[model samples]
Target chain A: DAGVTQSPTHLIKTRGQQVTLRCSPISGHKSVSWYQQVLGQGPQFIFQYYEKEERGRGNFPDRFSARQFPNYSSELNVNALLLGDSALYLCASSSDSSGNTIYFGEGSWLTVV
Target chain B: AQSVTQPDIHITVSEGASLELRCNYSYGATPYLFWYVQSPGQGLQLLLKYFSGDTLVQGIKGFEAEFKRSQSSFNLRKPSVHWSDAAEYFCAVYAPWGGYNKLIFGAGTRLAVHP
Candidate 1:
């Protein structure tokens, strides 16, 4: 089975612009989480969705949001992009029943200028 | 909120030499610990995990970790390092609270292997 997949592998945006990164969970998985990995740092949690419901959120600001579809696919949105937002956005998939082992995607690289 | 700490930011070792990467996690509950590796331009891959076991767990790619509950550490080890082992290693703790599943990761330790 294919692992978690993410789209728009690379993109560039300017201040005040908005960007959306997409993710598809592994087959039969119903939970999806988003994380941001700044250069030289570990990934920071952003949002988590389970079964199309918002389950948990990280310390990120209100400009960041996410949602999960019925098919377990997910989208992460960042508004009013800032230079600090430039980082690799990662998506991970897992199942609540299958233990908490998460599988991460290649990540979407976003650059803000 | 849970947290992880990796004391070493980077470590260099010669090929065929033993390798040990330190990881310490902090959580109130019984922690679900994990080790992940990320190569350049690649995604995170799970090396191993520890929930409740004999403290010694084996993972993929010739890696192993021993969970010391007393020390709150889960240090990863490789008997003999290979050149291909150069990568960033992360220690993570799964927060089993609020019916939410998420991992709190450490800052990560970058490994450089000498050929």
Candidate 2:
């Protein structure tokens, strides 16, 4: 079975630019969550979508948003990006709503210069 | 607020030696705990988890973790370490309350295996 897959493994953009990262969850998984991992830090929760609805959100500003499609795929969008936005964007998926045993994707590395 | 803490920022151990990584969590109630390992440029992989029942949980790649409720700690242990085991380890916790409960992760501990 294919694991969680993310698109544009690495991306670079200038400040004030917008970026959209894509993620496809594992087969048969319904929950997709986004996380941000800066250098020398652990992953921090961003947004979570399940059944095409926003389930939870982290402390991120309104500039960050995400959505899930009917196919269980997810996209994370960041607007007015700042240099601090440069970090590894990780996507995780779980089979149920319990949030147990989440599987992660290789992550999309976003670099804002 | 819920939080997870990994006391050690980095740990270095010789190959074939034993390994232990500490994790502590702060929450109002019983929380679901987990350990994940991330190799360089790779996604985080589930090492083990603790929900309820037995305190000892076994995970993939010969890894195990024990959950101590009193100490609010879940520490990962391996009988012997391999060079390939060198990676960043994360400790995370999930609350059981309603709504979209997200996992709170620690700062992570980097492991270096020396041959």
Candidate 3:
């Protein structure tokens, strides 16, 4: 089966602009989570959705939002993007919100200039 | 707050040599620990996880980890390192909040293998 897949593998955005990254969870997976990885840093949790409901959110600002669809796909949106927001946005999928078997996608690289 | 720490920022090893990456975690209760490896420009891949059971857990790609409750550490080890094993290794803990859970990851250790 295919693993979690993300779109727009790489993109460039201007400051104060908005960007959206999409993710398709693996078949039969019900949970999708978002993470951000700065250069030379590990991935940090941003948000998680299960069954089309927000389950958990990290320390990100209100400018960042995410939603899951009926098919278990997800989209992460960032408004008023800042230069600091440039990073690799990763999407992970698990069997459930509480399962320990999470898998990550290749991630979408966003560069804010 | 729950957190993970990887003491070594980078490590260099020769092929066919044994390798060890140190990881320390702080949590209120028993922690669900995991080790993930990421190649350049790629995503994270689960190497192994320790929830509850034997302290020593074997993972894919000739990797293994030992969880020490006393030291609050879960270190990844490989008996014989290969050139392809060079990547960033991360130590993470599953943090459960209410009915949901998320992973808290360490800064990660970059491994370089010499021929």
Q: Report per-candidate DockQ.
A: 0.64, 0.77, 0.76
Candidate 1 per-residue lDDT, tens place, A1-113, comes to 89999999999999999999999999999999999999999999888888898888888999999998989999999999999999999999987623478889999999999
Q: Weakest 10 consecutive residues, lDDT, candidate 3 chain B? A: B95-104
Cα shift from native, residue A110, model 2 (Å): 0.6
Task: Please give, as one word, the docking class of candidate 1.
Answer: medium
Alpha-carbon error at B113 in model 1, in Å?
Answer: 0.5
Model 1: residues >4 Å from true position, as ranges? A97-99, B97-99
Range of the 10 consecutive residues with the lowest summed lDDT in candidate 3 chain A? A94-103
Q: How does residue A7 of candidate 2 score in lDDT?
A: 95
Question: Model 2, residue A22: what's the lDDT?
Answer: 98
True lDDT of residue A71, candidate 3: 95
Stretches of candidate 3 exceeding 4 Å from the true structure: none
Kindly report the fnat of each predicted structure, to 2 decimals: 0.63, 0.85, 0.80
Runs off by more than 4 Å, candidate 2: B96-98
Question: Which tens-of-lDDT digit does each residue in B1-115 have in candidate 1?
Answer: 5779999999999999999999988888678898999998888999999989689999999999999988989999999999999999999998765666678899999999988
The single-chain TM-score for chain B of candidate 3 is 0.97
Q: Against the true structure, candidate 1 has what lDDT? A: 0.91
Candidates 1 and 3, the one with greater lDDT? 3
What would the per-residue lDDT of candidate 2 be over residues B1-115, giving only the tens digit for each residue?
7889999999999999999999999998889999999999888999999999999999999999999999999999999999999999999998743466898999999999999
